[model samples]
Target: IEKEGWSGEVSGRRKDGSPITILITASLVKDEKGEPICMMDSFVDITERKFMEDELRIKDNAIASSLNGIVIGDLEGNITYVNDAFMELWGGDDISEIVGKSAVTFAEDEDKGRSIINVLQNEGNWTGEITGIRRDGIPITVQLSAGMVYNEKKEPICMMCSLVDITKRKEAEEKLQRSHEELEIRVQDRTKELTKANIKLKKEIEDRKIAENTLLKKEKELELKSLNLEEANTALKVLLRQGEKDKTELENKVLQNIKELVLPCIEKLKIYRLDDKQQAYLDILESNLNNIISPFLQKLSSKYMDFTPTEIQVANFVREGKPTKEIAELLNISERGIEFHRNNIRMKLGLKNRKTNLRTYLLSLA
Candidate 1:
C-alpha cells in the first residue's frame, strides 16, 4: 500500500507466470459534492523488488547467500509472500504453493508458531528467532522481524517481514559463552588452590622461624648449662666437705642442749606436774594451731588444683570445726544461703552430691 485509500501488494505476472511483489499507491479523488467520483493511484512496478528478490535467489544459488530469510503474510496469516531465501531454506518453491495456506504451517512446532501468531495479532508486530522447515524438510533457525501493513483507516491488512539465518552465529556465541564460563570456574578453582598453598607456605615459614629461634635458644642454653654443670660439680664437692663438718657440730650442739637446757626445763615442768585441765589446754592450743594453718595448707594444695576462693573459704570454715549455721553467722549469711553457695561450689568443681564433704575434698587436693 502506498497512499491513502490505496491498498494491495503491487504485484504482476513474471515471464514464467510467477507473481512478483510490487508497491502500489492509490488515492481517491472527490467531486465538489464530496463524493468519491474518480480515483487517482500510482503503481510502482517494483521490478526492483522483484529483481532484488530474484537477486537474493540468484545469490543463494551461488555461494550460500548470507541474506536473512524472508516471509510475508496477509493480516489473516495466509502466506502471500516469501523470498527466494525462504523457499531455499524452507520447503516452498512456487508462491502459489503456499499463497492461500496459513504461513504457520512451515513452523517446526505448532505451539511456537501459534505463539508468534498471537503476538502478531495482539501487538500488530512480532520479531524473534523461530524454527522453520527447509525445502528438504530440515529444521533451520531464522531471526525474523515483521510489521503489519495498514490502510488509511489504520486497519492491518498484511504483514511484511525480514529474516536472517543466525544458526552459525547463535551456535558460535553459545560455544564461546560456555567456554568462557568453564574458564572462569577453572580460574576460581586454581585461585582457591593457590590461596590454600600460599597459606600453608606462610604457616611453614612461621614454623621454620619458630624452630630456628628455638634451636638458637637451645644452643645458647646448652652452652650455659655446660658451664653451670661444671660449677655445680665443684660446689657439690665443697658443700659435701662443709656438710660433714657442720653435721658433727650440729650433733654436738643438739646433745649439749638436750642435756643442759631441755633437761632443766623438763625437770621443772615435772616438778609442777600439769593437772588434767592444763593438759587439756595444751591439746586445745595444738588444735587451734592446726586450724589456723589449715587455710594456708588449702591454698598450697590449690596450686595443684583449681579451687575458687569461695570453695577455699568454705573448706576453711568446715575445717575450723564450725557448724554450717555458725559458719554462716561468721560469714554474715543465713545457713540456707551458705548451703546455696556450697551447692554452686560443688557444681562448679563437678561434684555429684551435696553430701560430698567439701572440707574432705579440699584436704584431698593435690
Candidate 2:
C-alpha cells in the first residue's frame, strides 16, 4: 500500500533486524506527469536530534526561571535572547523590545560595556561591576559575569551574561566612605585638643620645678640658721650654770659674814641685863637679821623648787618630820586634809616613786 505526497512516522526494522526511528518525507515520482505514478519517500534518523532538543528545552526553562537576570547575545554583541528575570530586571514587559537591541544599550556606561564586550570576544570571558539602566530609566549597579557560548563543534556562537543587582552594597559603601571622612575630622579635632593640653602641662611642670628649687634653697638656709642657734643655746647654758654657782657662793659668803660678825654682838647684848622694852627691841633686831638669810635657806630647803604657798608649807612640815595629826592641827584642818595636801605635794615634786616616804623624799629634795 502506498500513498501520494503523504508521509508519517511508523515502527520499522532495518536489514540487520535492529529497531530504528525515522522521519520520512513523502513525494510522487513520475515522468513529467502531474499525477502520481509512484510514491518516493526520504527516510531520516532523528533519535539523537530528539534527545538534543529535549535537553535544550530543559536548560532553557532553567535559565528562564533563574532569579538573576541572564542574557544571550550574538557574535556582533546584538541581543539574541533574554530570560524572564532579565526582562523583569530591566523593567521590560515585552521581549520583542529588548531582543534585537545591542547588549550595551542597557548599560549606563556604554563605554565600559563596549570594553567588556571586546574583552569577552578576545578572552572568552569577562566579569566586573557596572552601572545598568532599567527600561524605566532608573539606574542600578550590578555585577556582570559573561562568557562565550560554544556550539557542538566548539565554535564560538554567542555570549551568555549573568547579572546580579548590587545597588544596596554600592550605596552602603558610599555611606561608609562618608562616615570614615567624619571620623578623620574628629580625630584631627581631638589631636589639636591634646596638643594644647600638652603645652599647658609642660608649663605647669616648669613652674613646679622652679618652686621645688626655691624650696630646696630655703631649706638649706634654715639648716644653717638652726646650727647657729644650737651653738648659741649651748653657750647660754654654760653661762647660766656659772651664774648659778656665783649666786650660791655669794649667798654662802653673806650667811658666813652675818654668823661670824653680827651674831656674837647679839649674844653679848642678850647676856647684859636690859629693860623689857629694850630686850624686845634686841629680839626684833636678831629676828630681822635671821630673815635676811632666810631666802638662801629656802633654796636649800626646796632643792630649787618653785611651789605654791600651801604646797611649800606642806613640804616644809613633812621635811620637819611633823606627823599628819600635828600638821593638820598646825594647818587648822583635819588629818585627812593634811594627807590630801601631802599627796598633792608628793605628786607635784615627782615623789612617791618606789614607795618612797613623804618625809624622806622631802628631806632628800632639801
Candidate 3:
C-alpha cells in the first residue's frame, strides 16, 4: 500500500519465486488528528517500461557508434547531443564545448541562417544539402537529413539529424566536368586548324593546274613551228633535184646556211627551259633532225639499203625541209594519203614509242 499522495515502484518476490516490479500511485484525505485517512490508489506493472527504456538506450548507442554523423537538437535550435562520429568529423578535440550551441553556427557563411531549423520547428521536418565547417576550421560538404520529434503533448521536443560527407564525390564530379570542357575546346581548335590547312591545299592544287595548262599551250605552238620547218626542207629538196647545175650550187648553199646557221639557232631556242608541252614539241624536232635526215644524208651509206620510190621521195622532201602539204602536192595524193605513207615509213623504220611529232619522226629517217 502507498501512503497519501506518495508514488513509488517496488520489486518483490512473487509466489513463484520470481521477482516482480510494480509502480503504485495514491492520493489520500486525512482526519484532523492525522491518525486515520481515506485513500485512493492506482498501480501498474513497470517491467515493459524498463524493457522499452533499455531498447532505446541500445538504439542510442548504435547511432553513436555509426560511421555517419548524428545530432539531436532542441526545438530552440540548440544542439542537445551529438554522436562520436559527429565529433570526429569536427576535429575530435572537444565535443562538450558543442553542447547547447546553435546548430546553424557550424554551417558555412552561405548557410548561416536557421532555415532548416525553422522548417523543422514549423513543419516537423526538413532536409537538404549543407556546407559545414569543422572544429579546426576545415570546410566539408555533406548531405543532411533532419526531422522533428514530439512529446506526448505534441510539443516539439527535439530534432534529429544525420550527415553524410560527399566532399570526395563532389570533387570527382567537378574534375570530370572540367576535363569535358577542355576536350571540347581542343576539338574546336583542331577543327579550325584543319579547315585552314584544307583551304591552303585546295589553293595549291589550283595553282598547279593553271601552271600545267600554261605548259600544255606552249608545247602545241612549238610543235606547229617544227612542222613548218619540216615542210620547207621538203620543198627545198624538190627544187634542188629539178634545178640545172648552175642553180644547184646556189640552192645547196641556201640549204647549208639554213641547216648550219638558222636551224642551229632554232635548236638553241628549243633547248630553253620549257613546260611539259613545250618539252614534248622540242623532243619531236630533235628526234627527226637526228634520226631521219642525218642517216640518208650520209652519201656512202645510201647504197646499203633499198628504198621504195615513195620512201625516197619522202626522205628527200623531208631532207630539204618541205611542209607536209607541199609533199602531198608533189606526190599527187591527198594529205591523208601522204600521212598514211608516213606512218608506213615510221613502222618500217621501227620508230614506235616516240612521242615526237609524226612529221618529225618521218623527217628523222630521211
Candidate 4:
C-alpha cells in the first residue's frame, strides 16, 4: 500500500466492455487517530492523449525518413523543421543550423521566397521550379512544391514544402531538344533537295513524251527517205572524220601548252620550303595532273560513283606498290585507316572475299 498517494496510467474496461486507458490517483483517507478508514480514488480517461502522441511520433519519423528534402516553416516563413535531406541539400551539418532561419535563405532571393509564400497563401497550393542556393554559395535548380498546413479547425497554420533536385533531368531535356532541332533542320534540307529532284524528274518525263511523239511523226518521212539514206550516211561519215581530226589537233595543242607552261610553273613552286600539309597538297596537285593525262581515273570513276577522294588516293598508293605504313605516313592517317580504305576499295572493285591481290587489281585498272 502506498501511504502518501499513487498516480499512474493503467488499462481499464469501459461500461461497454471495450478497452480504455485510465489515469488513476489513489490515497488513503484516515481518521484522526491515523488509522486508515477508506481509500479515495480518481480516474480520468487518457486514451486521446496517447493516440495523439503516437500519431505525432509517426509523422516525425516519416518526415525524417523521406528521401526528398522536406521543410516545415512557420506562418512568417521561418523554418521550424528540416529533414536530413533538406540539411544536406542546403549544405548544413546539423538540423539546428537550418532551423530558425528564414526558409528563403536557400532560395534565389528574398523576393522569390516571399512570392512563393504569397502564392501559397492565396492559391492554397503552389508548385514551380526555382533556383536554390546552397550554404556554400553554389546555385542549384530544384522543383519546389508547397502547400498550406491547417489545424483540425481548418485554420491555416504553417507551410510545408518539398524540393527535388532536377539538374541532371534538365540537362538531359536540353540535350534532347538540341538533337530534335538538328534533326528537324536536316529533314528540312533533305525535303528541299527532294523537291528539286522531283521537279527535274517531271521535266525529264515531259521531254521524253514529246520526243516519242516527234519520233512517231517522223517515222513515215524516215521510211520514205530510206533509198537515199546510204548516200546520206556516206556524207555523214566524211564530215564526222573531219570533225574528229579537228578535235584531235586542238587536244594535242592544249596538252603541249600545259606540258610546256603548267609543268614548269609547278616544278618551280616545289623548289620552295613547304610544310607537310603544303607538300601533301603539291603532291595531290601533281597526282591530279597525271590523272588528267592518264585514262585510268576516268575508267575507274565511270565504273563506281561511291569511291571517295581518300579511297582513290589509297588506291593510287596501292597501285604504285607502296606499303600500308608508307601510305599512312604520306596520307597522315593511321595504318588501320589505310587498311580500312584498301578494304573499301577492294569491295567497290568487286574483289572482296576473293583471293585476287588488291595491288594487282589496282595495277590492272592503271
The TM-score values for the models, in the order shown, are 0.42, 0.49, 0.48, 0.57
User: lDDT by residue for model 2 over 1-366, one digit each (tens)?
Assistant: 244466666557789997666888888776675565777778888767766887999998999999989999999799999988888888888999998899888889899989999998899999889999988899999999999989889899999999998999999999999999999999999999999999999999999999999999999999999999999999999999999899879878988999899988999999899998688678756865675466633563436355656666666667767788976766678888878887777777676565788777656544
lDDT of candidate 1 at residue 262, scale 0 to 100: 53
* Lowest summed lDDT window (length 10), candidate 3: 295-304
| Candidate 4, 1-366: lDDT as tens digits | 456789999987789998788899999988999999999999999988988888999999999999889999988789999899988888877788778988777787779888888888787788989988888898878899899999999898999999998878888999999999999999999999999999999999999999999998899788879867988989999998998799768766866777788878889999999999898889878877677456676567656769998997788788878899999988899999998999899889999899999888877876
Q: How does candidate 1 score on lDDT?
A: 0.71
Report lDDT per candidate.
0.71, 0.82, 0.76, 0.86
**How well is each residue in 1-366 modelled by candidate 1, as lDDT tens digits?**
223586667667879997767776677788898778777877666767778788978854642343555666777677876667766666567767766778778788978887787788889888788887765777778888877878889988877777778878988999999999999999999999999999999999999999999999999999999998998989899998998699758756765665576555544655576898665555444443454344454344334346555555665666555688976765678889878776766776567665777667755652
- Whose TM-score is higher: candidate 1's or candidate 3's? 3
Error of 3 at 72 (Å): 0.8
Off by over 4 Å in 4: 1-4, 15-17, 30-35, 136-138, 207-225, 230-366
Residue 10 displacement (Å), model 2: 9.5
Best-to-worst TM-score order: 4, 2, 3, 1
Candidate 3 regions exceeding 4 Å error are 1-44, 152-154, 201-366
RMSD to the hidden true structure, all candidates: 20.8, 21.5, 18.2, 14.7
* Error in Å for residue 207 of model 4: 4.3
| Candidate 4 worst ten-residue window by lDDT | 292-301
How high a TM-score does candidate 1 get?
Answer: 0.42
**Model 3 lDDT, full chain set:** 0.76
Which should have the higher lDDT, number 1 or number 2? 2
The prediction achieving the highest lDDT against the true structure is 4
Clashes of 2: 0
